[model samples]
Target: MYIKPLALLLAVFLASLRLAAQTAPAGHVVVTHLDSKLLHGNPGGENPRRRVSVYLPAGYEASPSQHYPVLYYLHGFTWNDSLIFNQDGMKTLLDQAIAAGQIRPLIVVVPDEQTRFGGSWYTNSATNGPWADFTARELIAFIDKQFRTLAKPGSRGLAGHSMGGGGTVRLALAYPGTWAAVYALSPAFLGPHPSYLPGPGVGPALRATSAAEAQRVHTTLAAVSLARAFSPNPKATPFGANFPGSLGADSLARRDAVLARWVLASPLYTLPIHPAALRQLRAFAFDWGAQDEVKHIPPTCRQFSNLLAVYGIQHTAEEYEGTHGSRIMGSTGRVYQQVLPFFNKHLDFSP
Candidate 1:
């Protein structure tokens, strides 16, 4: 009771610090590598042991009896597992959203699908690794075993951006029972488009030159990624994949075969083959920005949505007023405002 002024101030300061710590977000990220039997071999010579980012809810440690839903997020082309923490700000957004009571507490996991070519295109291949199968089978099983996941389809959600967004739809259809609700944000290459066509200067960029031409180099790398994903050649030299367009007269005779491969890879054309699989999803939603930088994305997304409607599938399709990357940035970002809420509405939180 007879405390001095200095002692009183110190007590107050300690109390404030404790309060701040309590009020701050308590959840954290765990960056680790997973050894996948499915991803064990990469013909392109990229690392086969994949990197993964896992986010545990604030009370994951405190509530041992509680099991939460698992949300599988796929990063876009040229992005690694750590990007959600950096450029996209997704890790921060998830922490804030859970702390603010905007969304349910859930586990979020993203696989580093970025290969030497830029992205794996979320496809299974001898060259790029079976990213598609690894994500659905190996990755999911590993997370459920390592963490307190609900461990069932109804309690699982899948979401992605760019190529990963396309992966969201592709995986949902390819493996219908793996996820309950799925959302695709600015899903790239939903179908065949003019952008997939080989334009001039592409070969030079693929051969690679100066870093000053980063944009071109990245574009070319992405093209090669697509080739590796959609039209791989186990016998080819270097990357063990076929370029979509004519690299030379040797590739010319097989031009239509390569082009058709990509067309069939698109989720737009694959819809008919897997309507029953998609219809099993609890919720299906996709959105694209009107001014997306990918010149063909807007049109392809439109065609994809139209085809879904034509096939009598019940889903959500949105056209927003931003660019591809714009909708997924900042506190007021669409991923926080839209994507998370979509899962919260559809995902089962029981048990």
Candidate 2:
């Protein structure tokens, strides 16, 4: 379908006016969704909606005729399109990064990938929801048609944190041709680790004790839901059910199956399937706080790095010293620093 670039720009610009009243910084942008009534439930499902927040560099207006590569960012659970992507502080961070020569000028788009069960994990699922298609097809098409972006995979980068970090890893694996570089920050659980058992705190975190508590405590339950939701074993667990499958022996087995599925989907497990995809990548980087609450930060980082090493997939993995939430604020600037250069190194902006 044809999309008007000016129309998309106007829509976001107006939304930004409204967003300015919120707590976000001065230049906070708005991310909007355009649903496809016609394509709903097809391979990409109908309702091909695009939720995009764009950050243009300081001289974006002066150089009105210029075009730039785009950065696609996915937000964590509980955060809608506007929270991280459209926030004004992030825009200022980009501005500072560009000014300091830490990174080249570029556009960053953050979209909402949260599905019915809290988050899609950016995966397509009956249980977790159709976020994969929403992201890979719908969002990309809309942004390209409506923006002045350099409409090519090599000109693009994808990154996220927490649930979004999983989305980044999952999307990079699923559509190896879509992005030239990727960055993930403090990603959630990958799969069960026999050697990496959870601490006693994990009991409260996993909520393995009770169903209601599970719903309240277990963020890992989203992993299970994404498993059944996106890639289902219908025979193993019934459709449209809460994750961890209602807390019984059968439920536990089903949850384990979900974990097995995660292992299959994880970058650590499936990097071999897309060796060329990995090779095409200009950069792959992920970092987590040494004291991250959700997952064992160091081990997970090592796991991904070791897997990359085995496949000769060059990547950068670091263990920063911070927690999940706070570090993202401090590190987003650094992420832009890493990402913009990666794109500059890979994507040729000249026509």
Top candidate (lDDT): 1
Write one digit per residue (lDDT tens) for candidate 1, span 66-165: 9999999998888878987666766677877776666899999988888776888888887767888888998889899999999999999999999889
Tens-digit per-residue lDDT, 1-351, candidate 2: 776999999989978745543432233354566674423553322234545677766566677788778888788866766666446257766655555455667777887654433566777655333568778877788888876788888788888888788788878878878887888878765444543232222223233443344345334444434444445543442234333223444323234554455567665666677767777787888878787766555577778778788888788888877777754663354465555555556665654
Global lDDT of each candidate: 0.81, 0.63
Candidate 1 ranges with C-alpha deviation above 4 Å: 1-24, 199-202, 205-216, 247-254
Predict model 1's lDDT versus the native.
Answer: 0.81
Our model 2 lands, by Cα RMSD against the true structure, at: 11.0
Please give the TM-score that candidate 1 achieves against the real structure: 0.88
RMSD of each: 7.0, 11.0
Q: Please identify model 2 stretches exceeding 4 Å from their true place.
A: 1-28, 37-50, 85-88, 194-239, 242-256, 331-333, 336-346
Query: Per-candidate TM vs. native?
Result: 0.88, 0.74
